[model samples]
Target: MTLARLAELHGVATAYEPSEGVTVQVPDATVVAVLGALDVDATTPEAVAAALGAARRATEDRLLPPTLVRWRDDGPVRPPEDLPPGTRLRVTTEEGEVVEGLDWQPLPLGVHRVEALAPDGRAGGSTLIVAPARVPRPERRVFGLLAQLYSVLSSRSWGMGDLGDLRELASWAGRTHGAGFVQVNPLHAAVPGAPTDPSPYRPSSRRFPDPVHLRIEDIPEYGFLAPEYRDARDAVLADAAELRERVLRKGALIDRDAVWDVKRRALELLQTVELGPGRRAEYRDFLAERGRALEDHATYCALAERHGHHWRSWPEELRDPRSATAVVRADDELTARVDFHCRLAWLTDRQLAAAAEAAREAGMAVGIVHDLAVGVHPDGSDAWARQDAFAAGMSVGAPPDAFNARGQDWGLPPWRPDALAASGYAPYRGLLRELLRHAGALRIDHVMGLFRLWWVPEGREPTEGTYVRYDSEAMLAVLALEAHRASALVIGEDLGTVEPGVRERLARRGVLGTSVLWFERDWSGTGRPLAPEEWRTDCVATATTHDLPSTAARLSGDHVALRHRLGLLTGDLGRERALDAAEVGDWLTYLERLGLLPEGPGDEEAEVRAVHRFLLRTPAAMVGVWLPDAVGDRRPQNLPGTWDQYPNWRLPVAGPEGQPMSLEELAASPRLHRLLSVFGSLAEHRAEPGTGAGAGSAAGSRTAPPDARPV
Candidate 1:
């Protein structure tokens, strides 16, 4: 009983409601391990009793909670009931300005400090979080392009797509195809080593953008490299050309390590060049703004280059960022390496800004919609540097459901909810701020994590995990404040196993939810395709996602064959193929009935256009056209269940015949032009004033059978 009480106090669940009204008790061993991560002991009955007593006593003794959150729109904060009658309170803003007394004016939205003084000379301190009431929402409906950055190779790229390619893609899509935004996969820094994981969803640091995406020639200093380095630069360039040719001509997989090897060497030479006075001052400003987080990340990168990538393997003193021994170990050579990494971050940030600028210049309203990965790699800089912020020895994973009975362990550590609250969610705030720096809108992957997360104990299967709750109100308030400050829209990927009212709550807060076309159905009624009018107004409507089959693959029944070939299908291959074909036939039949599909059975490109045209018939605030779908690519950028069985995230954008297509080739394709003409014709509906309510045409309002399940 005491153990359960301790777990409850810490927001650790003793049992979870996997489905509404269904509760499953968490195992005792799991509870003990979870509590232990919180620095609480529950290993034995005696320990449980002692810990519970300590927890109760700690709450009673506190003059204030570790953190206090109040919306700026709300009236001035009231003093805590636990404060002594005559106790005085003083608040300090992040800018160092201080205010005294409980009659505090609505504070600015940020992390502030609060100090309490009692008549008896007692004192206490806490963090105060001020947030906006709600985030900003789009004023009108818009459509955009969705793409995976690395796969969209251009003629000027160094084997893999870089920021230069992003800029060009955005500018062309916005100017020529009338796209309002270009959503890209997460560009978060990956763990540095050979044979790096190709998936961007799992990254080393969410706070820092990966320098591997940097456009080598964009740095002004690149042009000034000494004539002595010309031969070496030429050789690197030749190698890059060969790599690019292999991907574009020979259909070779993208080699991230090879791309980074060339970029890293070139950056090393560029780092030797001195910055002008103005640029130096700007760099200093960036350093000052980033502060400790930037310094620690740069130091970790330097240390990783010296030792290996993982910080746990580093010497004891070096594990802690602020340790005196670690500082001493950062010699001149190490210091130079640190500076190089920092410069890379600044350069990447600059190019990202340039891409955003290019999009806006080419008439894109939202520009780039950057993705935020759910968590950081456990062995990466964030987990090592901010040790206290995460739960030790626990991995974030999905709960067992109808989709995957075995569940999934992502190998990313869950944040310690208590720690985040105590720090006024400083780390989360910092991450959002950095991501929004160059984004017009930000898409949060697994936004459900803001409420609760399934935590698997170290060495345990994902099924042996329990849901841990977070302070969602506080989390949303911080997100709203951040988005409001940045003038950026927020999109939550609220799909699969979402709790009831979660969608409603996010909508109320003005955070748009994702509405994939395949998943938007009237489940309350017949299990058929949802009428276009029934689709929600606040969402990003898309035909497919990176994890699912491409539009062409779905239409042609190619995904089934691919999965079967990779041995990923659970049922008989023949049965799977028949079911897949029927699903495609159903969608095609409905598209034909609506006058969207002009051609019959085997015309894949025309069917693809019809699918997107159906999306246009919906009232969703934003419609996302998968860049691959535009050119009839038949491969998914990622296949979730397989690792090496298929090239996930490494495949270049391809044609209908499975041939790689360069950006130049795509831009010149008449088929792409014809398909986009459909979107261009529907531009009027997108340009309709105000929210997308009643903005859709009535021509496609007839309901189809609700086959809302995603493949």
Candidate 2:
């Protein structure tokens, strides 16, 4: 390839002028070998000359670097003063080969390693170790949340799902369902106010959990509160009871913000009581460790409430995170509020740790797989506290694709690779360690980002975005190192637009991949659904994912109608409907062929169950059943693209009639028991093969009628 083309492929600009005809001094034999690999006819003088010219041009353009240099009889040449570490140099003489100061021996063909040596009498040496790059890891098994902790049982929660519900769900999955793991959306701290953003992905601070998930009765301070405050708590409980009644009797969607408002009021009253010595000490340690970052975050929230949430609209003195004026202002007026937020974070951390403990107590093999969002909100605590870590004028988004012809701008800034490396990846490592502290596994959303991210410059359209490469080796190395230390499994959400070789690399490092039945296809050819046996075992295989419609919605074609209603359908409605119908028909036929679906008219819920049972057919180490789908809940918890036009994240999981089910109701429901029974049977069957009809049947048995088998 030409130098310009190589530079373009590497996403490097080639504009620097060569001062003195940049010399490339690789061994002649090595040059011949590389040229041969490229299929160049080096034996011919003209071809040899052309190859040499191309090599020199490539080096000059910084696309390639020489491996070794030769000298007839000259003494060792001094290295360049400006040469950065990892620059490779070799000296060879015609008389005899004398390689000195070589740091790396038996270096691979294309990989690079850096080494530095002292200048006192000893010579410095560095070598680039090159090897064939590996592929990224495949997806792992991941469970989805049916509802947030405080939001699960509306009647019992101060207005949301609480820790008690989580404990119950964990116990049920561990003992009854025999599930490997349970995953939840980010439980990160939310801004303390009305109309809080419900999307967990866009959190105020990832380091802390939202106190709204706390159950009032469960709080240690609840019993010690003043009688009047206790009565106030009772009133909140009464309000929550009504909300729960609405969900059960009238089918109401969850109100996350309203729940938070109630919880905040109760927590404020409870905060008055002094914590015991042990708890107080723990809180102090947390604050000490968090230090200025926590202070800054809390101060920002306090100032935001006063000056509006947007940082740009804040008072000029408070705009800068480190300004003395801002510090004075915070100390004078926002100290109490800042301390309150910090206290909330400490309590949430305790609860998160408790939840993980609950999972262990429940006999879960892997407890609490926490999800790390791709990025935080642009105006959130992370962005404010760690501004230098982010790219100044760029946004992270997707390039033009079939799903989004206009491309997508996620409206979140990305980390500058250069800055991250310079800081020794402290921020990344810290975040990982904190999340993994209470998690059995950590799911990294947008795993492809570790390799490279599409950087959309400010004011530029997504189509105009350019791919900014990151040091994938370093990134993966850090991840593996952290996972190894934590003894926690790593699951990379390697879903859309993956670059080649990323999966293989991740798998090699023992990280797991994600596989959704809907998207698992023979992309190479034949357009066939990927066989269960052919699926990678080191992955989380599931029937559906959070981003996609539930199996019920897909089978009933409710998703199609919903999209059309939202005016999100780009193609003609008739054409889209025909395609959708054909896809659903194909799935039904495939299921019937495998004896998974009955020939008779099947209910959407039953079909959905069968589809999950089909997923269990795969040899995947982990299988996630979306919690909502377990009880035949049709509405998705989230719908992308439209924000206010649709209730994106507020919907509570509902029954067939759209009435919400409380945690207690869900736990006791026969419907849920039936679904858990499927998982229980699968686990039992997996323990001893050929015992159950589901375990005995092959996934591809076309002639076996669904009624003839139990799988």
Candidate 3:
């Protein structure tokens, strides 16, 4: 009971419902570990009792929480119960303006500093966050392509897709297919090393984009290099052509490390070419804008290059990013290396801006919709630079569910709730600001994390985990403010075992939710496929996601076979195949019955188009077409629960015949045109007012407006 009380005070869930009627009590050991992460000691009964007592005392004595959140929609400020009458308060707005007294008026939309003075002469302060009531929503129904950027290789790319390919994809899709956006995997910087983790979900830092995604020749320096360097640059380009051919012509996997090796060499030579005055000034401005965070990240990268990737293995004094000893250790040579990294960051940022600009120039209503990973790698830049912000020795994971009986640990460190509040969520706010700088929309992976997260202690199975609550009000307020400033839409990945009221709250905040077609059944009443009208309107509806099997793979029963071959199936292969086949048949039959499918079964391509036609039937404001689905790719970009057995994230985008297809081939493919025609038909309806056949018609043709004004 004492332990439960302590847990409650820390917002740790001592018990949770794994299923409808099953309540699983978190073990006492897990509770202790979770409390330890929060800097609360509760090892034994006596310790728990003492902790509870201390918590109660602290609450009684404090006049304000470390952080306070008030929504603009909530009206005015109400004084806390503990505040005595006539207590003086001074509020400092984010803009350096100050407000006096405890008036019942609304504060501006920003983080304010509030200092209170009690009648007894006691003084304390707190961070007050005032956020916009809701994020901006899409004005019209928009359709876009969702893709894994690295897999969408172009003929000019060096094995893996780069930002240059991204730019071309956006321009082509926007102009040719009338795509409103091009949504891709998180471009967040990966931890530096050979054979880097291919999954974009677990990044070293969410604040910076990865340099590996940079297109080497796209750099201004490359174009204006000295005549002497031309031969050397051409030689590198020749090697790159071979790498590109190896993936597209041959059956080789995308070698990211090999591609980066060549690009790095080219970059080293280009770095020697001094920048023009205007370009130099622009680079300086970028450095000033990024400030210390950029410096720390660049320093860490240089250090990683020098002393392996892991920071823990480095010398003791160099562990802290700001240590004077570390500064001394970083001699002139290391300083030059750090400057090189900073330059690379500046170049990458410029290219990303150019891509977004090109998308809008091509008439895209929503340009590049960037993805935000849920957490950072445990040993990466974010974890090292902001050590105080993350929960040390703890990992983020999911609880035990129907998918994996043992649950799953992602090996990513979660933010420490207490630390985040104390710092007024500076780290999180800064990250969101940078990401939204060039994004038309931001998709937050695992949006439930704002409310709470399932944290597993280090060295423990995922089952030995408990939920740790966060200040969702403050978190959402910050998110809303950032998106409002950017005039960008926000989508939350609200799938999986969501707690009650979470979806309702998110919808109220105007942050869009995610809706996958296969998962939108009427589980409450009939367990039948949800009719198009029954789908949620406030979501980005799609047939599949990156983690799931593609439409063709699901329809053709190849997914089950692939899983079986990789030993990822927990059940018998025959039974799994039967279940999979039945599910696909059910959907196909339903589509055929609804007149969406002309023919089904063996015509997998036709079935794929029907599945998308079904998506168009939904009233969702936004629709996402998986790019690979249009090409009839049978492989999942990423196969969850398998590592080396499957070349997850390595397979190039392929055609129905399992042959790798370049960007040019995909654009010209007859099959892609057929799939895109379905969207075009819906787009036609959306272009007309009062047609009522398209989701946009009901909204009075939000998308039929003139082409977006280019920035």
Candidate 4:
């Protein structure tokens, strides 16, 4: 392929200009492969001449430049042995000495600063940093939520669990259940509109929280509304009450958009009043600290509301985030709305911090463990605000695997690896610091992306996606440095088609891997579930995940039937049903063999408790109870790739009869007490073993099966 075609395929903008006379490094193998794939006969004399001419023209035109490409662990430290005549070698070590030598001794580990001065003294150099071998850290604790955050019900929640409900749940878990940490869904900011997207994984912005999570009554300014606005507020309250009643009494799925609509109307009124002096100052400081990024985000939201969510559909000027005309237009027309959105972000941040404080007050050891989604919406504030940092024409996705033969496009642009490195990974580090500010631990979705991601070119199927490598060493180094600074634990979602040695690398960095009970099998052998002793100690073990079915659903084969009914099953019904049955039967038989399952036809709740007890036996450091499992809510929160056809992320925590249970009622229920009692017994057993295991260890072991060994 021509250099122009190769650059286009890689999503490089046409306007890019290489530095003058720079010799860019192109992998010879890659170039030859590209040429062969394009059917260019490079071996022929005429073809060879044409190819050479094209290469020279491309290089001279600066369409392609010889850039140094370095891969982590490519080779041992060595100076360039084959420099051109009069080549000036300048080596700078960690000691900050610039020495001239063609052959220098290996620099000590850690970031060894190096600079190479070109022969002309018109220097072009880059840092040559050494990295320590990535090593796994000791596993930390992880406690699971029963359901999606907004889907959890409390008597006071407007038909769904809000931050208030989470605070209460965390308090109860820490004080009564002895949980070290509480893990919940992504809770990332969602696009604002009717019938809002329920899947938290596909969020508008991973950097911000969705205001929909805020409990209307919990706002400090809620009660201070004008009398004229009081009636509207009361109406909204009544609507919330009705919504809650629908879930609690009628067994209706929670409507996130409806809930948000009620809250948004009320919030608009609440915004009429300015923040109190202290809060206002804090808000100002936040804006000042965030600077132009905050302004751009706010402006994007404002423009989106006016011109539809997609920035591409906006007026020509507004389409470009950096356009001076767009800035002036937004300032003149949407200033108030932009400020309002900014205030919402500030309020959400305050509440998040408050929730952490509440956890600390409630005696929680790790406090809140927040989730980071894999990517942001392509048309959302984050994409518009940080357009320069992301790949414009490529989408992030997964390659075709056994499970998803067609692969999948996430429709979220990924950070350009080169751009991120050039920026010193500032955006990534900033996002992490914000999330970790109030988090005891952070769960990174699709942690494998730190190494490489499937980049699907525009207008191409997922099968055409290619792997774009990243600097995992630099990424993990930044992660470790930040985690150390924040004193927070890290859990990487390392399930599904992980590249070889990735988990081992993450483990070495003190980052925990995710192990779901169903998928944690010895794939190299008979594919049987991993024995507790065989389970990795540096990991979080769970029965299921948001993408999968609940324990009860999986065991009963309801998930299979649901998929079949929805026409999502690719295989014959009999085969799918049989596979599901056999998997569950194997687990049940294993549990019985381990003496964890009670004899006879056990109730679903009893079965779930048995599963937890089984998990408590595993050597894995962290165990997560899919929050829904706690209450026997046997539905998956999300089914991959389905939109509008299924009730994704709408189900509330319900009893067997499908009646939603409020947090107050759930907390007070005998069933809840029984569940907590089982957890308490497990905790007591671990403590008595003199393993120095506390809530953290027990929680970490929640991922293990019964009879599983201790980490």
Candidate 5:
């Protein structure tokens, strides 16, 4: 009982409801393990009593919570009324201004420091977050393209899609298809070395992007390569062409390692090029702006090059980024490598900004919606640098649910809620600021994590994990403040078994929710498809996501066969097939009933169009067209349960017959054009003014000036 109380005191769950009428207590061992991760020991009865008493005494003696949030729109800061009498307060604004009275009138929109001095001479300080009422929203109703950028390779790219491809895709989609935005998977830097983890969700560091996505030709120095470099450059160009052909023509899987090998060699050559005076200045400015965060990441890459990507295996002193800084500067070789990595970061940043600029110039109402992965790989750059910010010996995962009866361990380290709050959420604020810099909107993957996360001990199954809650008010406040500064929309991937009220809370903060057509059913009632009018206005309505089967696969019942082929089906194949078929049939039937689809039996292609047409009919603020769905791709980019069983995150966008298609081919694809025609041709489906509805015909809506900012 003491252990349970201690766990509860630290926001660790003792029990949870997997379903409405069911409850299961977390294993006592799991509770103790989880508490241990939070630096509380409850191994034995004596320890539990001591820990619980210590926790109680600390709480009773504390002057304030670790963090407090003040929305400026709510008026002024309201100090905790429960503070002991004669507890004096002090406020220090982010701009370095001090306020003695604590009135905080005309509150600043930044993270501030609040100090409290008790009558008994006890003093404490807490992070005070001052933020906007909410993030920005698109003023106009619009529809956009959703794609996995790597899967959509252009002819000019080395092999996989690059920032150059992103720029071109955004420009063409905005100008030709009236796309208001193009959302893609995370471009965060990957764990370095060959045979890298393919999933974008498990990034090495969310701070920097992988340089493998750079377009060598876009670098100004590429055109000015000296004659001596021509031979090496030509070799890389030939290899790139071969790599691209291997995927697009030869039907080979997207070899990320091979692509990086080719890109890295070419980048090494590009690094040696002499920067002109103006260009040198630009580079210097970027370095100055990025400061220590950029330096720390570069240092990791430099060390990784010599010691390998896994930081733990390195020399003991090098494990901590702070200490490693001294070790790096002492060695000339490491310093040079760090500088090389820094250059790559600068180039990647430049190209990303270029992509955003392209979208803006193409009249996109919302340029690019960048995806933010939920957490970082446990052994990656972030974990090494921001060591104190994360929970040690614990991973972020899911409890047992319908998706996976065994639950899911993502192998990503979660931030320590205590550390984040103690640091004034500066780390969280910095991350959001970096992501939103060039984004028209930011998509937070697993957005529910802002509230709470399931923490599984290092050696435990995901099922053994218990939930640990965070200061959600502080989390959302930091997000709101950053998004407001960027004038960017916030979209939370509030999918899966969301805890009750999570979606509502996200919506209240002007954060858009993701609503897939297949899942928008009345689960509690008829289990029937939700009507268009019944869909919520605050969502990015779409037919599919990267994790789910493509529209063609779902309609043709091919996903079930694929799952069975891969040995991923836990149940009888026949029953699974029947259930899947019935589910698709229900959605198709609903589409017909809603008059979104033509009567009678439709072909697979027509069915795909009908599904998206249903999305447009909803009063959703934004509608997303899965890029592959526009074509006839039938494979999922990621198959959740099986890692090696399926070529997850390695397949290019292919045709109905599974032939990898190039960006040029997709642009000219008759099937894709036919599907998009629905978006541009629907007359009666036009959203009424002031409805916040979208999917306006692209035919006449392309009149916005090139300079028009994203709505």
Candidate 6:
């Protein structure tokens, strides 16, 4: 009882329901570990009781929560309960400007500090967040192309796709097909290691773009290099060319480390070329803007180069990012490396800006829609720099359900609720601001995390974890404020098992939800395909995602076979195939009835076209077409639940025949152009089903082969 009370005060769950009526009590041990992560002492009953008492006392004494929200459009700003009348209020705005008033008043949309003083001289202060009532929404309905940037390689790319490819792809798509935006995977920085984790969802730093994604030749210094560095730079370029050939032609996987190695060498050479006056000024401004955060990140990188990626494994004195000893230990060599990394971050930022600019120049309404991963890698720069914010020795994951009986652990560190509130969600706000730096819309991966997250204790199975509630109001307020400030839209990836009322809250805030075509069924009732009109209007509708199979594979029932080959299927292969085929068949039949699938069921390309047509019929504000689906790509960029056994994130976007393609080839492909033509008349909000050129012209891949076992 005492323990439960303590847990409740800390926003830790004592129990949870995986489904409607099945409640599972969390283990006492797991609760203790989580409490410890939040810096709460819950090891014994006596400690818990004391903690509970302290919490009650704190609650009774506090004038406000660690943070407060003042929605600008709300009627009257209410004061915290029991605040004596005649209390004076003073607000320190985000810009450090102070505003005093007899009582709280309507303030600008920004984070501010609030102070209170009563007649008795008692003083109280709390962080006050003044934000808009809702986030920005798209001005006009739009259709966009979705691609994993790394997989969308071009002839000029060095093994994997880079920002240059993003620029060219966005320009062509927006100008040629009237694409409003181009969505890509997270370009967050990877933790340096012998073999870096390829999963972008678990990156070292979400605040900075990965330097590996930089197009080497695009660096201004590369073109202006001194003669002495030319030989070395050319050698790296040659190596990069060879590496590119190996992947695009020789059927090798995309080697991220190898690509980074070459890029690093090239960067080293570019660093030697002195900057011109204007360029130097830009660099200086970047340094000043990034300030301490950039310095800490660079210091981590430099230290990691010598002591390895894990900060804990480094010398004891250097474990803390701001340790005095660590500062003293920094030598000329280390300082030089730190500056080098800082330069790389600036260059990546510049290129990201350029890509966004190109999209705008091509008339895209919403340019580059960036992805925001749920959490950061435990051993990365983010964890090292802001150790105070993250819950140590705990991982964020999902509870067990139909998908995986044993549950799953994502291995990413979650932000501690206590710390987040204490810091007024500064870390969260800053992360959003940096990501929105060059984004038109930010897609939050697993956005339910704003409300609560399942926290699995270290060395425990994911099944034993319990949910930890976050102040969703504060979370959403911070998110809305950031998005509003940037004049960007917010799209929440609200897929998988979601709690009731979650979607409603997100909608109320004007945050768009993600609606995948296959999963938007009326499961609680008829379990039939949800009608186009019945679909949610506030969402980014799509046929598939990177974690899921490509539309080609989904329609052709090839994804099941691929999963079977990798032993990812829990049920009989035959059973799985039937289930997949039936789902595909249901949708195909539904499309035909709606006049969306004029070519009927059997033709694969026609079926894929039908899916998009069905999507367009829905009232969703945005529709995204998987770039791989444009051409007849049968391979998934990523396959969850399998790591090394399957080359999850390494495969290049391939054709239906499983051959690699350059972005140039994809752009020129008639199939791609034909599919995009469906939206040629989208501005009119009515694209005739079979009016797109080349519909039913060819049957490249059948949704279900004739030779397949009968469904």
lDDT of each: 0.82, 0.62, 0.84, 0.68, 0.84, 0.84
TM-score of each: 0.94, 0.77, 0.95, 0.81, 0.95, 0.95
Report the Cα RMSD per candidate.
Answer: 3.8, 12.0, 5.2, 8.1, 5.6, 5.8
Off by over 4 Å in 1: 72-84, 118-122, 324-330, 681-711
Which model, 2 or 6, shows the larger TM-score?
6
lDDT of candidate 5 over 175-272, digit per residue (tens): 77767788999999999887899999999999888898899899998988888999999999999999999988998888888999998898888877
Off by over 4 Å in 3: 77-82, 104-106, 324-330, 681-711
Query: Between 2 and 4, whose lDDT is larger?
Result: 4
Q: Residue-pair clashes per candidate, as listed? A: 6, 36, 0, 28, 1, 0
Tens digits of per-residue lDDT for model 3, 1-711: 778888998889999997668899999999999899888999878888888889988887787888888877877765455687767989988898888887636567888899999888877789888887788877688788998899989988998999999999988887787777889999999988887888888888999999889988788888788898888898889999999999999989998888888898899989889999999999999999999999899988988998877898888877899982367345988888889989989999999998888777766777789999999998798888999999988999998787777888889899999999998889989999999988888999989899999999999999999999999988998998888888788888887878877878888888888888888777776667888887878888899988888899899998889888888889999899998888888888899899998775578899999999999889987899999999999998888887888888788999988999999999999999989988885454332221111111112111001110000
Report the alpha-carbon TM-score of model 4 versus the true structure.
Answer: 0.81
Predict model 3's lDDT versus the native. Answer: 0.84
Considering summed lDDT, which 10 consecutive residues are worst modelled in model 6?
693-702
Candidate 1 residue pairs that clash: 527-706, 528-705, 528-706, 528-707, 529-705, 529-706
Candidate that beats the other on lDDT, 1 or 2, i.e. the better one? 1
Stretches of candidate 5 off by over 4 Å are 681-711
What are the per-residue Cα lDDT tens digits for candidate 2 across 1-711?
353333333332223211134422323332233233224445456776675677566544441122222121123333344544544545332223433444323332222323333433233433232222221221233233334354466456644576666766766666565555678777776654567777887777776566777656776877788776777778877777776666556656668877677677778888887888987898999999878767777777777767766776666767778882356464765777778878877777777777777666655556777888777777777777787787766677876554665567777778766567555566776777678778777788788788877666567676656565776766766665555555567777777666557777677656677777877767666767777677777677777666677777888888888889999888898898899888777777787788876633367766776787678787776678777777777776677777887776676666665677777777677776766565654444221111111000001111100010000
Report the poorest 10 consecutive residues by lDDT, candidate 4: 702-711
Model 4, span 157-244: residue lDDT tens: 8867888888888777666666656788887888766655677877877777888788778788887888888888889889999988
lDDT of 1 by residue, 291-326 (tens): 889888888888888778778888877888888236
* Candidate 2 stretches greater than 4 Å from native: 1-117, 120-151, 191-194, 246-248, 324-333, 598-601, 685-711
